[model samples]
Target: MTDKNPFSRRQFLAATSGVMGAAKLYGQGAAGEATPAAKLALQGGPKAVQGGLPQLVRWGQPERERMNALIDQTNLFYWKGPQTTLLIDRFRQTCPLEHVMTCSSGTAALHIAVAAAGIEPGDEVITSPISDIGTVIGVIYQQAVPVFADLGRNTYNLDPEDVARRITPKTKAIIAVHLAGNPCDMHALKTLADQHNLVLIEDCAQAWGAKFRDKPIGTVGHIGCFSLQAAKHVTSGEGGVVASNDPRFGPLLQRFGDKGMDRLAKGGLFEVFATNYRMSEPQAGFAAAQLTRVEGIAEKRSRLGNLLNDKIASTPGIEPHQVHPDDRSTYWFLMFRVRPESFKCERAEFVKALVAEGVPASAGYIPVPLYGNPVFQKHGFFAGRWPLKEQGLTTMDYAQVACPEAEAILKTGVRVTIHEGMGEAYVLSLATAVRKVATHYAH
Candidate 1:
């Protein structure tokens, strides 16, 4: 939270002062006529976001110093390793989990969590159809079925009711992905899990400082998985952490992440099989430094994304990304939708206009839901064959899996960049860019 900002005094002023003036000017023109700000930059008019955006400085001297300290360590192993210890401690300040294991990547963290949760062959893990493949990689690896569930229409997260419907006797766990750093409806999901006696794993890779109803995301579920990928809120170049308060799974995290070795018992006998997914001390130290910036970055991004949502709330064809007012979404990115019949232009044209106006916007998020991928469609998870299906242990068929709402969301969604480097005025201008394009093309 006390991380240093890289913006110089003048750069700060340039981002703040100039954009503030632009927002004030956006309201009117001579004799209250439609201002030039209302004109689309696509029409050769003035761009809303002038001077572009200030550069973001993700790491600096603090990260450097941590790496320097890391080099002095005699061994780089994560077991009782100092850097890993500090990294976990810093992470605990925010998440407060009793048992944590740092691993090579978010994918590894998820696999470790799944194995620790005892998700075995033929078991089903219900999760949203609109997330990174890493979210389900572990389930597939464990020879479990990843049952695709429909998402909340607005939240881009798993709809608890839909998840409930998809649950079967074979259901072993529910993986709630906090998509776009927005927390899922954990209360309802947790209730369902309890009623069904299933494990709940929170995929928190995208949610660094996100909170659901004021509770940190990872604390609610049985196991929490986080990413430290280069693009995430924090980074150790590439790494992850899996943790839990549930004693059933907590003590097993280390074993699962470290080739099924029980370090506590000095790893003599192997009851389960696992792969090597350890993190080096250098990465742990770097991540520990990155943790310091989490709060500051999350708070700033939250403010900017919320500002953009508010400014564009009334745009006729645009539906602002939905985030609960009580939840802190940190908004890794804002995803809103455009109702096709409400506008005079196609989604591609609309996106072009916004980008021309200097809004960092794109036509949609993912091209298709995760289930629609070639591998899923063809049932080729492992070397052009799925052993689970071949053995008939599960009668699952991915080609028939349908999550229409997720499909619709991806079709209509527009992804807008929102980061901590951005100032309020820049976000306000982004709002103006959306309004200008939507209003000009209003049918």
Candidate 2:
């Protein structure tokens, strides 16, 4: 009954036992004997995922308490504001970076990192080709070039080998984007950055609370960027945080997000040119509250995600999302690959079959590589003209750019929705749904 240990051990057991009880009903098929999913639901049999997913309760009392505290505050500014201060304090407890800055959006956090890292016009930054345009928008706006590298077939994160091959004399930094909350192979990437004397920026927008090799993901790189957009693991509606333990880039984060004026300097001529991307105190407070829930949310999703992978591992032609044993992927949404040759169905049909069996599954991620977009193909940045290429500062041509593996990934990847505290029974049934559909559709 202590404050720190509020729940009794018996109560904890009772709660978990209920979830375990349901799991027994949805286990994999027994050898030879008929299982509940022996007949495929796509063929007029019962659906596997009985009892739809539990409704999500993303925010409530914790968020409201923080909001109430803000209501009595005198200002909404972020400079030394208590809410912002508390948010940063709470964040550091999790990520533990010496210098941190909360900003307007994840894109802003990265732009600050790139600008702080001193990327200049025509400087090349190697990154994944199959990510949200936000991953490169900062580099482009800084007048730097984003060298799109191929990715791993199963991991769906940047391929370190391809990254090393893309490195050139102009490479000033490498932005390692942890796509779908899966940690990139940071060890190889960090080695490449150090050997080449280039900065390594970890784009961790989707990977809140994820770890690489037992160390928090953002810590291994020089700078780490995260998103708190509504879709992320934890959110403040629209906010971001950038952090770095490196003294070289740590001190510059604040000014880059605050109009380039060093608040620590009190009153001095603005030396750095930047925009106002500061996050307000209200958003900061809300984000601080969300931080309290992140580790719990991450753990639940990680466990459930791995369980789904375990449940579906033996299905023919299916490649479960590949996560390193030492790394923790928060699984914003579990993305797996389906071998085309082993299936008698197209990707769309395979996804439809899973849906019919009551699994929330969909084919592919993005439709094409970042360079495949018309804007890149047309060399149309900055009102339909890219100055870096026009001024002869760069010789890059996106129209000729290609990453075959990345292109194939978007064609074969299947996204399965997972959530915080998703019951194990439901996860088991989701696996059953996949097994049923995959078995029926295999050649």
Which lDDT values do the candidates have, in the order given? 0.85, 0.85
Tell me each candidate's TM-score. Answer: 0.92, 0.92
For residues 1-443, write the lDDT of model 2, one tens digit per residue: 11011223442243223221123223333222133446777778888888766788999999999999999999999988999999999999889999999999999999999999999999999999988788899999999999999988777888898988999999999999998888998999989999999999999999997889678879999999999999999999999999999999999999999999998896688999999999999999999999999888888888888778756654667766777666788888998788888789999999988888888888888888999999999999999999899899999999998899899889999999999858888988888788777777767
| Model 2 lowest lDDT segment of ten | 1-10
lDDT of 1 by residue, 134-248 (tens): 9999999999999999987778899888999999999999999999998998999999999999999999999999888778879999999999999999999899999999999
Model 2: lDDT equals: 0.85
State, as a TM-score between 0 and 1, how close model 2 is to the true structure.
Answer: 0.92
